[model samples]
Target: MQTAADREAKLQRHRLRMTLLSVANTSLQSVIIGLYAWAGEVGWSVAWRFFLVGAGSSAMFALIIWRGLNLRLKDPGLLLPQIALSVLIQLLFLVLAPKLWVLFLVAVLVTYNFAMMSFSARQFTLAWLLVGAASALALFAARGRFGHFGTSGVSIAILWLFFFLCIRQLTAIGTQFSSLRTQLSEKNKQLSASLERIQELASHDDLTGALNRRSFMQLLADERARAQRAGQPFCIALLDIDHFKTVNDRFGHLIGDAVLKEFCAVAAASIRVTDRFARYGGEEFMLLLAPSTSSDVARVATERVRQALEAHDWDRIAPGLRVTLSAGVSQLAPDESVEQLVRRADEALYAAKDAGRNRTVVA
Candidate 1:
């Protein structure tokens, strides 16, 4: 959910803060040394030397900051964790005082800034720990060369300051990560819901909620695949309501819509679970059969659909009204396209219409 601009803003803020913090901490050390030498302990030359050392360390630290900035441009998400750890390491080396207590400070810096942040980001935890441990070893070597007064006293003091900074940074990261994750979750939920709504709208008739003509054709394809896989047998029938136009003529469009819905309900309920039902078009419906033989399934299904609609008591809207349907049934043939199957069934339906007003035809 973070746009390029948002990420760039985050990077720029970290860059500026880290750069300034590094410079400030290093320069403060230089100032202490310079003031001592300038008070005539070691002379002007020594003071200038210490100032140069501090300035040069600040510049090197700044250069590494630039390296991380480049890595961000290349891979912000994949590389920032390591980049942040690198920057923290540079800060510790350049800033912390030479004392035994600084060992504690370095450990705090490693765990809080490097280890904690990397783990929270779900990045490299082990690598960070190893890097921190290496730094600790380096501090131990320095202590051996210089000598500790009692304990790692200087490292301890520096660690307190570093830990405080890390706590603040980690808190901010936690807030941002939580917000981003919440937004992502909400967006995914809405997307899934939208797809379900669209699927319902696209695959079913808007007026009757019956499978529409196009969707019916698609379902046939799925059926063919399934049938082919399982070696299953099935049949399909196309039916059109008789005297549908007469109902519209007598009662108008509103009443005609009610009749269509009523007919769909009957057709749906009359079919087997394995059967497919659809509105082929206005005044017409199709029934896709499953493992039923020849004209028998077609006869039973058509009869039930017709009788249910006729007996449903729609007389108050149009008294003593009677309704019937002509249906055409077809069975699946080996390696047949959906078009071929539907066409054969349609021919049969027309045959039934030609034979009589009410009957089931099979092909």
Candidate 2:
């Protein structure tokens, strides 16, 4: 089972990877900015300042996530804060280097595009509005100095190509994330099915599909407690297949297993829906009936199961094969404990076996 600590650790690891990816994105943007600075489109001092601030901010976020500090926040990914800071830095650089304003504008778009991968629709819309308002204010303040595509045609084309390539890369990353989410969803479904199968195996018999001995005992204990508390009476029946060893010795264990399965099916159909039935051990089964007024009711229910098995066609399985059951029924008494009640039922079962092979004895 996955505990809270394990889930938290997994989240931290994922967040760390995201932080590293953000840092790499910042480095890539810085590279482009450095290229512009080298070509004299933007001042070297302004380019270097932008690089320092952007990279420093990314590193700081990475450190916070790595140290498990972001767990304190509602959004542990720190996505909104990162987006806000990145946009503000780009806008600041836009003001500082208006000659390269177009590049910074593209950078702002790229940042929001990346945010789309993690942000909810509402968050994305809010971020978009805030960025739009901030961009308008910055443009108004630097309206007279805002640069256009006045550089050489080659330079303009190259910048345009670089921006397009960046957008394409972000699109690819989004696609990859979408695919991974789908795969994770499928894996979770398979995991749920596997867990359910494991639980069934733990509680039920593998061959007969009846409750295993351990699970049956647990149910018996619970029922006993409930019956005692409510001042009610329930009954237990210990049943054994008559001449089971002879059949197994004559026909082998495979046919013996088939007989066991078919007997359980008939017994289950004969009993009330609320009754519990289980395989106690080899060729021995136990039944816990719902609350009854007398041991006669319990005996009648057990007899129905015996008659059902006796009436079933055994020739289909093996020629001239026959099966019968002997059961012992014991009703809970006012002062009887679970172990004592089961012991009485067991003794009655032995009595029935001694008197005749195919019969039920009440105690």
**C-alpha lDDT of all candidate models, in order:** 0.66, 0.86
TM-score of 2: 0.63
- Which whole-number lDDT from 0 to 100 does residue 10 have in model 1? 83
Give the range where candidate 1 is weakest over 10 consecutive residues by summed lDDT.
94-103
Residue pairs with backbone atoms closer than 3 Å in model 2 (clashes): none
Question: Tens digits of per-residue lDDT for model 1 on 1-363?
Answer: 899989877876665555555455445444543443443323455435544654555566566666664454454333344445444443344233343234334433533453433355445665556656766665665564342333254544434545565555556557656866898999899999999989999999988889998999998898888877877767888998888999899888898898888888878887878778889999999888775345676667766776676577778667766777888888888888789999999998899899986778778
In candidate 2, how many Å is residue 77 off? Answer: 19
Q: Residue 363 deviation, candidate 2, in Å?
A: 0.8
Q: What is the TM-score of each candidate against the true structure?
A: 0.57, 0.63
lDDT of 2 by residue, 48-84 (tens): 7877899889989999999889999898989888888
Positional deviation of 195 in candidate 1, in angstroms? 2.2
Model 1 — TM-score against the truth?
A: 0.57
